[model samples]
Target: MEFREAIKIALQSLWANKLRSVLTLLGVVIGVGSVIAVVTLVNGANVYVAEKIYRYGADVFTVSKQPRVISSYDEYRKFQKRKIIRLEDYQFVLEHCHRCQAVGALQSSTGKVVSGTHSTTDTDIRGWTASMPPMYNLNVILGRSFTPTEEEHNSHVAIIGTDIQDNVLGGNDPLGQEIRVDGVPYTVIGVGEKQGKSFGASQDNWVAVPITAYQRSYGTSKTITVYAKAGSTGEPLNAAVEEVRTLMRSERHNRPGEEDDFNLDTNDSFVGLWNQIAGGFEAVAVAIAGVSLVVGGIVIMNIMLVSVTERTREIGVRKALGAKRSDVMLQFLIESATLSLVGGVFGVIGGIGVAQGVTAALGFPSSLAVWSIFAGLFVATAVGLFFGVYPARKAAMLDPIVALRSEL
Candidate 1:
């Protein structure tokens, strides 16, 4: 028999037992669907993290009093023992780091901002140096940044985030308007561009002010985080980090051979942390999906065995009419593969719908990769071929005389 004839026979056989075929395909459907859905979510999360959390420009690194990732209470206590980063340390790095093109400092606090009867609660208020806007890509969409003189004299000028403008000021022209932040009045000199959402939370819910002004209002006791940018045409980021580290260690009076008390983080560090987290999730998801596929393959094998037994007389008739063993084997293999392929097609559609539903319901971003769909289909087909082999061989090896005499 030709391969096409075998395929036609296989399809006819499946069609004749439609309910059984559907039942046998349940495993493949679930396995492929789960794999595709998990992959889509993980891929989308990676993209979101890269664009939002790790959006710092190349050649920039931040210096702070403690590590960003602390695993235990002991570690947290150790970090707490480290001296708080002071404004003098920021000034020292600015004057001493020749490889750096720009240096800035930031201190953050949370407070309520009131504009007339409107107010925003628990809004982030950042105190930053004049160079912070360019260093951190904090673009101004309306009005102008406060002048250096304003920063020097602790001027009560403020830059509001998009959320503050829309929620607290009711979308009015906030430029030159006075808003009270934690009871201190500040003139809105600029409005920052919208930063969208991250991790299901709004990023544009804050106000920015000069670090000097922040100190006057919020006090000088807050820990400062220093930012430095490498020169465009000069030293590499590693060299710049090391330079800052050496300067900080000296200023903090760290003895030689002792571990430095501060932490330095770059954009790559954030990416690495995200990779560690995302990698773990991917591994667990794949393991669960693998179990489902394996169970589905077992079911297909059992069902195919039953199918061969029930069709013994039909097989005997086909062999009596000159059907070769290879022809019989090929026909069974095609049936198994067709079943799995059908299941895979349904699984892909289901997975896409699930991903979309999750994104819409939770407001989380999800992106489907075309390669994941193709990979899922291919794996499902392979599972069918692998599990179908034993049943197909048994059917091909059956004795024609015995099979013809057997009951249906």
Candidate 2:
């Protein structure tokens, strides 16, 4: 029989037993849908994380007393014992780091802000040097950032986020308004551009003030973070990082073989950490989904074996009519493949739908890639073919005389 005719016949058989075919395809649908959903979510999350990491800029790096993430209490203790990164350290780097295009220092804490009776429940309060505007991408949407003189003089001027402006200050002319942060009044000299949200959390829920002023108001107990950008990206950034590292190590009196008592983090470091987390999630999710595919293939094989049994008389008739064994095998194999391929098609659609549904409900990002679709279909078809072989072989090997004698 011709391949097209075999496919037509196989489809008709599937349609005739619609309920059974539907049940058989369920596993494949679930497996493919899960795989696609995970891939979409992971892809979107990777992009989101990368964007967040590079929010300040690609060339920017931060030097802090502790690493970005501490996995254990022992590690935290070790970091706590390290020398604190202070304003003096920041100044040293600012004055001497030639490869650096800009340098800044920042420290932050959470506090409540009040404007008359209107008040924020909580907001991030940051103290920044004048150089932070350029290094930190602190885009001032209203008025302007505080000048070097203001930072030097410890002026009580502030830059407020949209949350502080709209929620605490009533969103009128936020610039020049006075808001008290933890009972300390500051004149809003600037309003930062609105940063919408991330993972359902508001990004625009913070305020920035001069480092000098913050130190006096909040006390100088907490460690400060130093920010810097290379004169250029790529190689220059590496050169800048090394120059700073060498200077910091020498200043801290670290012996030649001893490690520096500080952490240097860039956008790529954050992205790499995210990738490690994402990779593990992908592996676990895909493994669970693979089980479904295996089960689906088993279900298809069982259905095909039953099909061969039911069509025993028909197979006998075909053999008596001079149908070659190869022809019979081909027909059964095609039927099995068609079943799997059809399931794969539906599975791809269902996977995309699942991804979209999750993204919509949770506010988690999702971006479907074209390759995932093709991959789903390919896996489905392979499963069908592998499982169909035994049934196809059994059908092809049936004895005409015995098969004819048997009744269904």
State each candidate's clash count: 0, 0
Q: How many angstroms is residue 204 displaced in model 2 relative to the true structure, after the best TM-score fit?
A: 1.8
User: Candidate 2 residues 69-92, lDDT tens each?
Assistant: 887999999999998887888888
TM-score of 2: 0.90
TM-scores for every candidate against the unseen true structure = 0.92, 0.90
lDDT of 1 by residue, 151-203 (tens): 88999999999999998889989988999999999999999889777556678
Please name the candidate that would achieve the greatest lDDT relative to the true structure: 2
The 0-to-1 C-alpha lDDT of every candidate, in the order given, reads 0.88, 0.89
| Alpha-carbon runs more than 4 Å astray in model 1 | 1-22, 232-235
Looking at candidate 1, the ten consecutive residues that score lowest on lDDT are 49-58
